[model samples]
Target chain A: MKLFKKMRGGLSCDDVMEVLQSYLDGETDTETARKVASHLDECTDCDLESSVYQNIRVSLSTNKAPIDPVVLDSLRQFGERVSRGEID
Target chain B: MTERPTEVDSPAASADATEAFNRYVIPELEVMYRTARSLTRNQTDAEDLVQDTLLRAFRAIERFDGRYPRAWLLTIMRNANINRARKKRPDLLDDPDLTFERSVDFAETTGPEELVVDPTFDASVTDAFAELSTDFRQVVELVDLNGLAYQEAADILGVPVGTVMSRLHRARKRIRDHLAEHGLDSAAALPRGATR
Candidate 1:
């Protein structure tokens, strides 16, 4: 939809995670901040969605779990690519 | 020299930047991975995406001001993921068997049951959250999950703050409507803490 497009396009899954991050941090603007608030008002889905994304990223105060070894290796290789400046 | 920061254009600078990145920034690999995982919801894709991002950051480190190093790297990751995603084909209806396979026991690593907060909802909340379009999910991820400021998210997303808020508002509202339609919450109950 054009409206969604206006929000911007090509955003990754990480971009969808901001609901709880901005709210808990208290950095979200009053009005835009209310987006989360207002979303909660009528939509339980956003409420849950916001909270779940929070769980995955922050896990509250607990240390984020270690990534899988294979995943780490991939990142390491990607990092090597970066260090090597091989990506176009 | 090429306008883009390239290894060949200035090997010394790239080398110095990579050394500094490895020492000071690469240590955040785990953190980047977690963020990437949350975004991609696929362990393999998340790792590759983060790897691609780290590589991009290393190459572009010459332009990095060493401010908000993690966020800078995240922006690179976020952008790389988007670009790579565009290169793929979307074939939702092409294969019924593949769809059936995905729907059977196909679970996001982070399920609603494992989710930390209770948020006064039930089982269907998971389905609703899953149903949201990718755009809405992006706003929730950036501002709500990772806690990047609107300006920073804007920097990564290349949108105005107003656009961010409005999209977040509408996207979230749509999700709420979805939940309500699913009969997950009551309209008359004593309203626990407001959803905000």
Candidate 2:
């Protein structure tokens, strides 16, 4: 907190957060995203958040458990049964 | 019942749902189970809770209305687990440290850093996250991992978008620092722009 006092309101944890979220969602524009990227390269604290957000992106995207085929088949059948009014 | 040469979005949805359930939801079981394990802190209770989430998800899908099926599924699972916990023990809501001990004896060979390389880093990160006050962790999980837009995650969690944004920043910073203190920090190993 003390370290970032120099950046002024021009760059804040919130601005960095917006950039971080934008980066993860792949929604940031080319120019500002680039600025955020370059700034992060030099800013250790921002770099830490940048790192965590990306890892979070990967973990959520890739590390999920695989739902079983039987479970899926079972759910599909249940969907069918409900569509047919088999269950109240 | 036959594979149509052309895709019907409805039937296709069912198939895609099946596939998503298999490809996405199934893979998350252990992780979700691990989360449930952390939340419940008992193997039997975690298993029961997980099974309940699966069943509830299937039932909920019948009337579900969302385009992002995976996020919708996780939302259901998360809500289900929380409701079950509340029902099981209403009083423990405020007291978080009841279940798991704070300290972990990480493996010597890997140290904490090596383990950060694995996807289980979420578990470590999540444990760090778990250390936070629940209000912060709620917003972090909803917006960050679940990928809801600020307003959407807020709408689902019933909070203001501004609240979600700020709490998330605090929770995120605390998580990063906690990982650092525990030696699981990913800053040194991660892609450069990633940390900034």
Candidate 3:
């Protein structure tokens, strides 16, 4: 089934996997992204691969260390000082 | 010796520089701090690096054409970080605790109770992330954790954009493989059409 789908002029599973990360990252060009999307829609294996990668991204993204608001506030104040020419 | 007159020396020019700094630099402080944290891997050093970058950006604000300010500031931050690294003791440069390994430790200590995904899956991903080389971990931290674009991560790492993409893809592939090994790559783990 996958082979038959590959012969249908869309990106093969190999081609999709080659650029899969870029396609997921939204870094692929529009045409390539469209092709990859089309391939994923038709290929169960590639779609599962994409899902696993996406899940990994979500898991890792959720693991971000909490940013300290105090530090951000301090930086903001420092930037304000710079804008006011208070810091040399 | 008399200092030559410059654009920044005039009152009007100083005001323009200040406005430009406020417009371009001020809004990006959090992002600057996050990138600094990724580079320095220490809170105190990250804050100091950002402060240094802010100062340099202020000094150069008059010359900035108000385009791609984040990229502009990241370049300054990268330079500042390089200078800071140069001044550090050689032994201190090899401090493993100051690496992204610490970020993994932080993840272990913090709970992801709010995430709806499987805890085991999350743990597997974190384990895979912790095992990545420093180069891979740095790119992941900058692009994934800090939400930086490929070019932005490359600028901060002083590498080519292609290098960033290559490292990021390879690193994530490692994590995906780890997940597959743990049997977490099953279709049941992820719904159909699930994507970020």
Better of 1 and 3 by TM-score: 3
Query: What is the full ranking by TM-score, best candidate first?
Result: 3, 1, 2
Ranking by DockQ: 3, 2, 1
Winning candidate number (DockQ): 3
lDDT (Cα, tens digit) per residue for candidate 1, span A1-88: 2233112122222343454545645666676565555555545544555554333333322222334687676666656555544554
Considering only chain A, what is the TM-score of each predicted structure? 0.40, 0.58, 0.89
Better of 2 and 3 by DockQ: 3
TM-score of 1: 0.53
Question: Worst 10-residue stretch by lDDT in candidate 3 chain A?
Answer: A1-10
What DockQ does each listed candidate score?
Answer: 0.13, 0.18, 0.48
Give lDDT: candidate 1, residue B165.
75
Candidate 1, superposed: residue stretches over 4 Å from native: A1-25, A28-70, A73-88, B1-19, B34-42, B82-107, B112-124, B175-196
Candidate 2 structure quality by residue, lDDT tens digits, B1-196: 2223333343344654454445545545544554454344455665666666666664555455546554565466557665765676788576533322223221211233333446456566656655677566555545554445666555544456677677876777676676677666764336423332
Q: What is the C-alpha lDDT profile of model 3 across A2-84, one tens digit per residue?
A: 54546312787888889998888889999998888888877878877888888877777888877879989998997877777
State the displacement of the C-alpha of residue A69, model 2, in Å, after optimal TM-score superposition.
Answer: 4.8
lDDT of 1 by residue, B1-196 (tens): 1233554564444567768677646777876776666566667777777767766666677677777886677678667766666555346334321211122121253444454444434334445545656655566556655556666666556567777677666655554565567553344122333233
Which of candidates 1 and 3 reaches a greater lDDT? 3
